[model samples]
Target: MLYQITADGLVLFHLSFILFVLFGGLLVLKWRHLVWWHPPAALWGMAVEFFHLPCPLTDWENHLRHRAGQAGYDGGFIEHYVWPIIYPAGLTPGIQLGLGCVVLLINVLVYLRLWKWRRTD
Candidate 1:
């Protein structure tokens, strides 16, 4: 029971982290100080997707699920939790690279705007 709860918590955390990586630059635009945190996170997020690296959070979630006597899944958090809801097609390397590129592009645009705004100020 405890392990199951922990697994669920990890899934939530993983999803939240992904969201932050995708849009955290916007948050930086508002907070300014968040610039310190968001860029590193965005890079890590992109690296995981672009390089096909395993995310530690997914591993922890699987470990917890196994400890709880649940069957552990084969893939990452997105494959296990997100892919089913959004797309019937399985996740592929091409899709992963595209996601990474999208993340990088969005952050770049946001930061560029922020830089321009700062210069004008």
Candidate 2:
């Protein structure tokens, strides 16, 4: 029971972190106070994907899953989750690079909008 709870918690954590990467910059746009953290965190998130590093959350989740006697996936979490969203077939280098670009571009656009809004106001 404890292992099941822990595994579910870890899965939620992984999913939330993905959300943070995808829309966190918009949060910064809406709340200026979040600006200090969003760019760095978003960049760090992108970098982790670009370099194919296993996130600590992924590691923790895998550990929890292992404890639950489940076999965890081998690739990074994005490859396991986001790839299905972005591509119908399995991931290709072009798709992977595009995903990275999309993440970076989203944050850049969010920051630019914030900058423009700040200047106009």
Candidate 3:
């Protein structure tokens, strides 16, 4: 029971990190020091999607679930959680590419805004 709860908590943290990677640039707009942190996370996030790499968070959660006598899920965090809700179709390379591109586009737009804002100030 404890392991299950911890696994669930990890899932929430993993999801929050994903959201931060996607939108952290906006946060940087408000808090400039976040600029140091967001790039690495955003880059890693994009690399995972673009390169079809597995997220360690998913592996850790699955491990915890198994330890708790629950059936572990296959694939990454997004696959088991976010993808099913957002895309009814099975995940594919094209879909991953699209996801990566979306991340890239969001970061680019946000950073451009930041750049302009800094220039004006």
Q: Which residue pairs clash in candidate 3?
A: none
Number of the top TM-score candidate: 1
Predicted candidate 1 versus true structure: per-residue lDDT over 5-82, tens digit per residue: 999988899999999999999999999999999999999999999999999999899899999999999999888899
Taking the tens digit of each residue's C-alpha lDDT, what string does model 2 give over 1-121?
Answer: 6876897887777788778887998888778788787777788778776776568877777787788888777666777776679766776666666777888998888888888999999
Ranking by TM-score: 1, 3, 2
For model 3, what is the alpha-carbon lDDT of residue 48?
100
TM-score of 1: 0.97
TM-score per prediction, in order, is 0.97, 0.85, 0.96
For model 3, residues 1-121, the per-residue Cα lDDT tens digits are 9999999999999999999999999999999999999999999999999999989999999999999999999888998899899988889999899999999999999999999988998
> Candidate 1: global Cα-lDDT?
0.95
Candidate 1 runs further than 4 Å off: none
Residue ranges of candidate 2 with Cα displaced over 4 Å: 85-88
- For candidate 3, the C-alpha RMSD (Å) to the true structure equals 0.9
lDDT of predicted model 3: 0.95
